[model samples]
Target: MTSSDPGALHAQTLSEAPCGRRLFIHALNAASGEGQEWVARLRELGFIEGEPVQVLRRGQPGGEPLAVRVGVSTFALRRAEAACIQVMPADAS
Candidate 1:
């Protein structure tokens, strides 16, 4: 991935993305059936690829289960669960 190329930039996992920065769902990094489950679950929760999300809060000042907003719904997720979600800056190409 190249920093200068928005298209080439590697997607950031939701667990590592800075709080308050809007992100676009880019991919699901889970493996095989696990990935499908995650993708289905996320989709059921309104978190499909190309949708916008933002980190709304953190747990225990610094812990798992980050609270995020997708569309008009807000939900909390553990770091491991969120790690499967790859995202890009919302305003990026």
Candidate 2:
């Protein structure tokens, strides 16, 4: 990743974030082949760049679904969906 890349510089997929820690949206990656619709839907749900988010909890066992909070809303997302979202430490900026 380059310096100009928003997903670079201490960035990591949201699914990998630790529960209860504050994080900020860095960028969205469509490389997973989830299509533009998936990206658009995530954005529509307030998963925009610079938005603060938190991984509230992860499902037991395989950790398929993750409970996340963005802005004023919270939603459960599959690990694949959460993988599409890049995030950084809330103190990075």
Candidate 3:
């Protein structure tokens, strides 16, 4: 049997990362009650980690607005807001 290559593992980890891809909530960071509410809304929209999400569309060439889809719902999010979210690749394998 072939053992997993450490380099391959690391590459996978980086490539499957959600850093550049719009992803589901996965988990929420510390925040105020209002912040939690907003996070909850995102969750309700299927912004949970491991959920299928795609960058359905992007806003202006270099704008913050981006169209993302969680399940069947599509929402627009700012780059800063998107950064708060962490996600795993939908096609990790």
On residues 40-88, what C-alpha lDDT tens digit does candidate 2 reach at each position?
Answer: 8999999999999999999988886999999989999998899889899
TM-score of each: 0.81, 0.89, 0.57
Candidate 1 lDDT, tens digit per residue, 2-83?
4675553758888998889988888766745577787678878988888998988889956768999999899999887788
lDDT of 3 by residue, 63-90 (tens): 5476777678778876655544545444
Best by lDDT: 2
**Which candidate has the highest TM-score of all?**
2
User: Is candidate 1 or 2 superior in TM-score?
Assistant: 2
Question: Local error of candidate 3 at 45, Å?
Answer: 2.1
Clashing pairs in 1: none
After best superposition, candidate 3 residue 56: deviation in angstroms?
A: 1.6
- Each model's RMSD to truth, in Å? 3.2, 1.7, 7.5
Candidate 1 error regions (>4 Å): 1-8, 31-35
Worst 10 residues of 1 by lDDT: 1-10
